[model samples]
Target: MTYSSGSLINQKKWILLFHFIIGAIIGVLLLHPLTTMVFWYEYKGLIEFPGNSPIEFLIQRLITEFKFELMPMSFVFALLGGIVGLLFGLYHIRLSGQKNLVRSLEHELAEELPLLIARGESEHLEFKSTYRWDVRQQRTNRALESIVIKTIAGFLNREGGTLLIGVEDNGNIIGIDSDFQTLKHKNRDGFERALMDTVKTSLGGNACALLHCRFHDIENKTICRVIVESAVEPVYYHEDSVARLMVRTGNSTRELDAREAHAYLSSRTTKSFSL
Candidate 1:
């Protein structure tokens, strides 16, 4: 999403400058009278009502010579400077927020990658060795595809999460080699296409849009990363007469049967959040 003025990257210096100047203008307009009143209250009572003493004469002379009250530069500069500071401060906050988000993803990818896999599953993550084809054993297991789809559908139904294909539940990055072997292209691209096709057939085109897939080569194995965004509406895996609806709960994917599914869907609690 683009901001009010420019692209997030590339020659964006002008955008910052623009924001600062605009902020300064707004600050001046908003705070000028308020600041002036504050200074007037603070100084008028002090300077105008100097005590009748030796120091009073000196104070009177100082006021006459400096005319500090009449000098509007102080208020103008303070107002403008404060606005510019706030402008940069807000921008820095935004930039830092984005940086932290990226850092979080990087951390998630690296931290306990093996340990987490060994620990088994969680609400946000799941691991699988193959999609439908077994690379090492060389076999087609259609049930495996159902498991993958059901998990993905559940994830979409809930918080939306990561599904690592080619990694066993034991945290092994076995990769999608089996699926790759069966592919005519024998590549990550072919594997991703097949995965997408499966998703399309089971979850529909709109649901497919919520999914993003990438291939990562770690330790000479190609692990497929499937980042599923939470579906705005309900997502179901439909094939033949049966449809599987589930949600990721704790370390397991819980299939929702009719009575439970109806109560859950009827509650409509998931609407408050975005993917």
Candidate 2:
């Protein structure tokens, strides 16, 4: 799970060594012959038109003058070796990154963040530019709180997902600056508290237990990543006089009536109990 610094260093060394050896072999087989030919024909001018055919001339030239430019030719080969090593090293790094992406989703989210933001919207992930920042009105969007709560409740009633606030649907981080302006503390803490208050008020105090909110400053923008865990009990976005049950279907959130919700919950519990 954890790689020591010494092991990582050794891994790098092995990759470099392997690439260097391969490059040296290729340089010897490919570049060496071609370079020797060029030197013999152009610089030396030892092979006259009738003195010898091209093949015989080349073979004899290589046999005789192979040592003349040995140091310079070796330098060229070393340069080629370094280039090959660098290319392969870069490829190895890329493959390592891809493996990490496939192996640990948590690592991807935490470390490979550019790829994480670029992962886009799915059943397990959603993005919102802001909680209450209304671009048109130039103020906080009042309906934003309910919308977020509904999304959270939807996750709770379904397989659960991460809700990234301050990230647009198109995966752009506009930041929570507008929302922060409305808060008293005018920072991440205040914004988080306000969000939790909204969650507790809109859904229930108990729903807060199912959600964990964390703030990240990325690309000079404050992003709120809320991880909503699937609840044992189906969650409902309980507004005044209306407890609307919501669920996640693909990338969109859908609401269910009280009767429909009861039947869905009943069927789910029955299936779970049987399993």
State the C-alpha lDDT per candidate.
Answer: 0.74, 0.79
Total clashing residue pairs per candidate?
1, 1
lDDT of 2 by residue, 52-104 (tens): 55566556544644465565776677669768877887798779868877557
Model 2: lDDT equals: 0.79
Work out the TM-score per prediction.
0.57, 0.59
Model 1 spans with C-alpha error above 4 angstroms: 1-119, 135-137, 269-275
User: Which 10-residue window in model 2 sums to the lowest lDDT?
Assistant: 44-53
Top-lDDT candidate index: 2
How far is each candidate from the true structure, as Cα RMSD in Å? 14.6, 18.7
Lowest-lDDT window of 10 residues in candidate 1?
57-66
In angstroms, how far off is 203's CA in candidate 1? 0.7
How does residue 219 of candidate 1 score in lDDT? Answer: 80
Error of 2 at 118 (Å): 1.2
